[model samples]
Target: MTEIPMGPELLSPGQSCLATVEQLLDFDFDIPAFQRPYDWSDKQVSELIDDLSDAQRKEVHLFLGLVVVCTQSNGRFAIVDGQQRLTTLMLAIGALGGTGKILRPKGGGVSSLWISPRHADIGFAKALVSTSSETEQTLSQRRLKQAFSKLSDQKALNLATLLGAQLIVYVAPSLAGATGLFERINLRGKDVSQFDLVKNKLIEWAAVEKDSIVRGEIEDFITARYDTLYRRLDPSSKEEPFDSDKLLRVHWILFTQKQFKSSDKVLTEVDSAIDETYSSKKSIARWIESYLDSLVRVAETWVAVERPYEATPPSWAPQLKHALLDFARLGRDGELQPLMVAAIIRWQADATDLVRFCEITSFRSALAKKNSNHGRSYKWRVARQLYQGTWSDALKQPISLAADAVHQLFWANTPYWSQGEAREFGEDLTLEQVGAEVFPDNALDSTRFYKDYRHLIHYFFWKYGVYLQHSKEWADFTRIDISPFQDSVWFGNEERFKGWDIEHIYPQTPADRDTREGRAHLKVMTQWVDHLGNLTVLPVPDNRGMQNLPFIEKLAWLREQKKVPFNELLATPDYRGNLLNKPHWGINNCKRRITEIRTAAAKLWGFDAVRELGVGPYDNRLESYQEDIEEEGGDVPDNSAETVAA
Candidate 1:
């Protein structure tokens, strides 16, 4: 009989079949030398045996997964997809000796069933088939032996069942056919990710151009860089690893503000999007070149999150590292990632201010959308504009971005405070405090300032710390000098207060009283519970201890017991002198204290510099605050006289 041609034609339809143990051993399986080394751990080995045993008990035909083999010109079968399974099966049979012999070609020189590539694992695989002893067995060999270790009681039946198990054996006639089949499986198979599909689509497009060189280059680049990119992402999740597709989509959105919901859309629409601005091959090539560059850089930025800044950072390093770390941790969920990436890339040399600017912008956006997540469409529009415009423009007109983006953010709903009531009462405040020129109309409604709790707390502490250090009031309240409370406290290193939280100055709960007086105390607690005036940042552990303490006892603890800077600030006469005389901690004192704190914030946040700095004529950005007048049936409270000592 004439033999079939040694090419893809040999893999014609209906050429596939199942093989028994005896037939499979006679077939001369050759593990391709180019394949990756055995990486299946012990768990996989055990699972295969357990599954096979269960199939046998149920009396069902066990269909192991697919195995693709190429018929070589020399008539040997080259194992493709099921190398792990096939290799494990041989080891299992070797462990169970009575069934049949695993053979090598007959000069009897290489008597093993498997031919492994020359590597550390090759010797290990050889030892598994050649010996029955467990002594000095490699990890893989040990796992293989363990799978069949208990089956020594019924070696013949178990080995027969596993070897004869049916698998869909795909026989490709030639090497090229096998490769094409493998590539298709990896690209469109069940485990395929959007990244894999998108990559395949890109190469397919290149292939359409009949540019084998370009196609080959692209494939090579993907094969080489795929693992490196995945290693950069969070490893805990197995469902979706580092989403390269999302990364590319973000870059695309930055440039076009267009959303691609699936891998198909990315490939189908990306070229048209490029064509809108550039129709020539040269322009398309340049665009792809830049896109690839951004991908590489963004990957580096993502990985940089796991590490700390170098000991000696550049002038701008602190803010950049802080922003990168924050994004690495919290900022990933937001729409501002592209902007964050842009800042990192642009200001890398002196990225301090730019990173800070991005952090502020991102946090501000987060605060703006506190009730809901920022939508991709919103971020898309902003990112597109930022990309089309210059980075300098973004830095120069932060307020414009703030105002425009905020207006766009809550375009559908009326503005109001998110959760908290205004601590500083104001309706007609001009933004001139930061200076009139800096803002459009140079007026920011200070009433909305307290709504962004985190930004406010950070700004207050940093500014207050700097001011205290300069005025020789770091420890002492007045000209009566005292030793510095703590030398150079800075939020620059957050680990210094890793366990700290924003502590309420007035305890959220009043002491429990059972009598009529106790009931009255409880009422006061309820009235002032979450009041803005009552809060300050302190160590979480210290705050826990202070909770449930009586008002006066808390005061004494702050003054005499706690070394916490903010707690000490509250204990100072300038801050609590008015409250000191009050017989009880009531709603009145909380309101008045809130007013004093607001005044301090105004100074720290440049309320006085507004006019000189051309800062704002911006209104408070809270939906709750916007309805304050209608909700209360009165104008927002007037704390005009509640100014602090500036």
Candidate 2:
């Protein structure tokens, strides 16, 4: 790795150099790997020049440096960096030919360098230039030629001449060493992405046979399809920096092999399996070739339909890609037939329309065999077959494939039972039994099953609710006081006893103190009273009238209202000893009662009563309010009597 600095003299226009196009194209000089493509529009470029001119007229020297790498071929240079500067300079030069152009010189012609357009850099350079024309210019051989011809004919050749005359500092190094140097220099700066590396590799490998058609198609597919998936999965991190190698590895996994499984299994456990099967470069290359061939076949089929090339492809491409990967994983697991069926269902059916088809089929297949060891045995068998490819022949028959795969899952796993005796000694059940039974074993297993099938459960419950809205089973619930001590319960529902707002509970204003001392005392009091357990939802009218009342006064009011069998209930051993024996008896009793109510509510909801009894899920009545809002049409009224009762 050596750097040879070129002198300050600029090269003359129209001078030929021993430059091969490949030297200039070998690396991306302007945009870094992770950076988005060049997006500066003509308007932006024009504005930039206007700013530069304004600065120049103000006598501010804009220092711009050029860095170029000389190629092995003499007089030839590959732009290692600073292509943005060079490109912009050329665009400004071209605009100077038009007098009204913002980037044009104050005086046109000679001063503007509008010289002969037969400059050597024209052919290799036009792609990076943009003009204020309607026609979209793409970087291609034909476009380059056309642009060069127009510049020459219009005698706007000064642009290229001026660029050629700019001071260029050159550093020459061997290609192998240049890569290491490039990586080091870019390590802390704008870096290349893994996708770029893969794309470059594909292009280079295909270039030998001029077979870029497939490569181009794949690039377009990734840009339009897979990129959206990445964005969806990590929206906030979408623009975060990425390593080129990591992205290439991800692309290889998705595109090349069906080695990874899609079992709704978390990645933590499956990562080891992935490393064992598809981690090698050689394995990835083989997989890529096979997958590419399959895609080529699909593309050919696409071309045969309707107006062929003129017709756009089906919108199922993304789904097909995901399904294909899933199918491959299933095949690897030896569950080929079942996976084949799943693939067909995925291909032919709309997931929304055929909601339970896949799950039902999979469930039915598992129920076919009664042996307790069947499910585990089948999984093992599938794993073996994946490596052996024994079931590869049956993949084409989609229905048989699905049925057989599902059958294996059903028979291999044991059916769950409600009682120990039933679990240990139950007879073999049919698919219907497997689906409908809610045995003790099933209940026990539901925890694990729910973990795996949570998404499906949520979907079905939501959909079922939507469907049942018009059914007789859908009933609007009204709050009713069922307690024996109705007066006390009602009193507790009002501000006189329970509707103590935190702010008033610990009043900031001291009865006879200076404002600052009163505020300090209030802050400490507020901290203690602001707890959720201290707060209670109550009737707003009652709350307004009871603000800042003393605990003794509130207790007396409650007694007068007969809200509680106050003397007896408060005197009971359990209540007096456990709840009322605190230093702060009123607050402590209130907290204990709140806990009891929350536990009861949680039990009614079929949630863990003890787990939710504190000032947590059970005490948070917001969900109940939300459920009410969902059931009825309007939002829950802030001061509704029902809300106060809860």
Candidate 3:
């Protein structure tokens, strides 16, 4: 390849106009394989023409002379440079012809000197000639025809008119020696970063399937629900559609580094692995989709209830990147599934305040030192603190404290002891009250309490199940229902026999059946059935046909339907036991069962079953339990209480 000095030349209207369609047609200007695809829309093309016209009216020398490099090909000139400009000129020539001006030979023998119709540029040039008439046929036709006539009649025209009139100075180099020159020219004054190029190239390749539908499906699936994993760092100035670079990095961490194989590895490799994967887009889309699906499933357990939005701020790009990596690692290690299942359990039991639970847990995890084993322990401690204290104060603690609490709860089983117990345990801690000092009577206050306290309730539930035996005295006195049987059915055995299927006193199919009367009836029946005042475990077969039947008729139907003598069946241990042992006609049965289970649960959590814990009837009561500890000279709860004493 050779470099020759081409002076600053202008495309003057009346000058020799040496740049012919022949030279342009034969040139082979190189575009790199990694460059972004042609993305100019029609409007952008129109803008370019307007700019050129404005420059021409101002008489500013906006149009520059074409640079042509000649490549030897069997004695004919093949342009090894400036194809875009050459091709565009052919488009302009074709546009001129569309105005009905007959293009004739320009300077005598010059027409014969132009390249023949068989040239590659001829096809593109012809397409342009057919379409340029749409611009302005009346005023510019004469000048356009003159321009067109300057090229040979034997030359072929382009199909589409190239809109932008920017001059491209071509550099023709020998086929054997142009790679380095091409690379250098392409890189000149270009701001396309290596990382951006790699990412763009990968997305382009992925978009190239023969079936557009398949390509679109892949793109849609990849981009749908992974803002956490691949969100743009700064959307204000972005030119690309999405954060493919960040997504690529996530893919690398998950698939390349195998960071999802273990929690420790996830903890260790997540950051560096993401960094390494940031640039290349070649395998990114597929990799990202797979990685994100796995990550979400794992995070379902590890994240607290409110975390989907709160754990990583939407606009905080760096943290979001790290968070996704962490998710990938957690998934690989098989540690996140159980945690997600636990979160699901909490969500199902009482969806009242899961947001606070998620937020507090996230705060606990983020605040801990990188790779700290104590992080899980610290998180539980933070949750316990939030439960026992005031809401406003809990929100004020550093986010790190909350993160540490989450780490402790999940990984270490750290106990959150009462203030007094915390002092005895002698662990470093932060304690504060939570909630509004002057409680409001509105629903917001109630919601806040539920939101703030649900995490602790979930923790308790996970540790002790639904059993609350330690509170037997309080439960029995209050007539609480806490039976293990989720549903009940009623059957009878008097003069007229009938039966009743209690169903899920809560009516699992609330949406399936709809009628005001039906709903009202269900509501009343469920209230009666689910209450501690009414519930009975009867034979499943006898209860099958008992739809809304009365007591005496139901009894007769039950005897007939079940094919058993009423007195003999009633005399059985199960039937006699219910009638004689608990005299309130099975009302006491439900109350007794609930009281017993609640008492057991209370004892399991180390509270006295008989005492009131000084809590109000409607209050969370757990909060009152916290207050009781404070009155008894405790400092506040911490992680040490998490473990059961040997």
Candidate 4:
């Protein structure tokens, strides 16, 4: 590899050139309408001052990151990226009275910034630089006041910060280029991903093409799609959110029929995959453009499929939602993420078969087989068949895995269970089959399959309770802590919403563990505790209140919820019977409740041959909350059903 010698700029990008903050402020920049208003809080303004002060003290140039812009008429430029930072720098310089000392106002104005009308306090922004103060009537003015106050507090904003703070400025040949450039630079990760490299490659090609119109078209295609892609694709509420690496890892294959090798870093894996497959430059470009298009097209539905906490899923397409949620419980489906992106966006084929195929494959693998090896065996082969004629998958072949063939196709991918056959899956399943299969019974005929499939079990009960109540929306779930670096999503807020959790009907520990009989009784409770029959959802408060109480007392408490305000649990037919008459919830109760729930769950989760409209399945009650279940998040795994990678 021929190495390019590095420059003294704070950061390096081959396609971008360096500029100082002082050099930047003298040039006029038209803040476009799409740019967000200048609304930096006092803390943000203080931090920016503190950062530059620290850098000045250290006598080091701070890399201010990339500034992407497109040249406009009158020697001015339209701000695409760096609008926020650039605007702040202008305010800081003006507060320090350095504006008049700088050279050019090419627009021949007092200020170089052409504030967007969307900026609520354009008067205040202009006043800050032009020495005519505006009243703080709007939120924009309030924010501007804070920034000016901070800058004035510094007495004199350092000339070193303006001179030594370095940034690379990319003058995009067109608006499309500017947008595409912004997209690449804004990808939230320390490592450069394939998306960034591909954008860089496209920029290199556009330079070769040199035709502004052609370059614009290519960039325009990417520009139109990426806004939606970045906004909706990543579950921001999640601790470790999705990034370019994840987008490439899981969905890249569906778009390009490329498999991610275990050894591959996200940066090289994609480039290598494309290089091996598409030799021609034209083929590679077409595939990337289409993949980006597919990503944008799939983004909304994908977010819906992996909706975050505190958001209620739309009530429409209830069956599909339930199936997606059930699939989520099986853990993150890397194989399915690509397939789902394909199903929802790129493919012309029907999605029922796709969902059905993935449902069975994921369910059977995670539950029955307990490993996804066989389920993921033909991952790329399926992609090939599905997208045969598309640019990503170039082989012209007939599409085969329709509704009728979906079952057998999955059968081809999955390993046969000791007693399993195609019909056992293809045909409509019974509670007996679910008991024997999906949530299988152990050698003692007790495991009650999917018990270990934690997310689904938790989700099922939560959703079922809502379904039973005929509620319009899902209840607020306590967003669990996933990142040790960051505290709870609601860190400073009230702790009242501990969110709901899995509760065992039969306690895992005896309330009187201190006694010999309590210890002896605990042995009996452990056998049935994890089973679906033994499970139900309860609020953290209720679960704690009723936890380790006797079975009859728990049932009586549930009955009290019927009259209790804000009590979601109803002692309906499912919970009522001779159980209040009995002291303990026996194996017979587990069998009966398990059967009832299985029937309801089968209908809700779409195991039934026909789609039903009116109602859906249920899941719930208390075990002392275990870390394993809470820690293994996502009613869906972070990677499996929703996305992939750390």
State which candidate has the highest TM-score: 4
In terms of lDDT, the poorest run of 10 residues in model 1 is 637-646
Candidate number of the best lDDT: 4
Q: Which lDDT values do the candidates have, in the order given?
A: 0.47, 0.31, 0.31, 0.50
Please state every model's RMSD to the true fold in angstroms: 12.9, 20.7, 22.6, 11.5
- In model 3, which regions exceed 4 Å deviation? 1-34, 41-47, 58-166, 169-190, 196-240, 251-429, 432-646
Q: Could you tell me the lDDT of residue 268 within candidate 1?
A: 49
- The worst-scoring run of ten residues by lDDT in candidate 4 lies at 614-623
Tell me model 2's lDDT, rounded to 2 decimals: 0.31
For model 1, residues 65-118, the per-residue Cα lDDT tens digits are 667786755666777567777776776776667323653545746544543422
Span of ten consecutive residues with least summed lDDT in model 3: 487-496
Candidate 1 achieves a global lDDT of 0.47
lDDT measured at residue 170 in model 4 versus the true structure, 0 to 100:
74
Clashes of each: 38, 28, 89, 21
What is the TM-score of each predicted model, taking all chains together?
A: 0.53, 0.31, 0.26, 0.60
Candidate 4 lDDT by residue in tens digits, 254-322: 544434343455545555645643555555446556666665554555555444221224543545554
Over 4 Å off, model 2: 1-188, 204-251, 254-472, 475-646
lDDT for each residue of candidate 3 in 250-355, tens digit (9 for 90 to 100): 2322233221221233323433433344554234445445544644443332332222222333443443323332232222212222332333333332211222
Residue 515 in candidate 1 has what lDDT?
Answer: 57
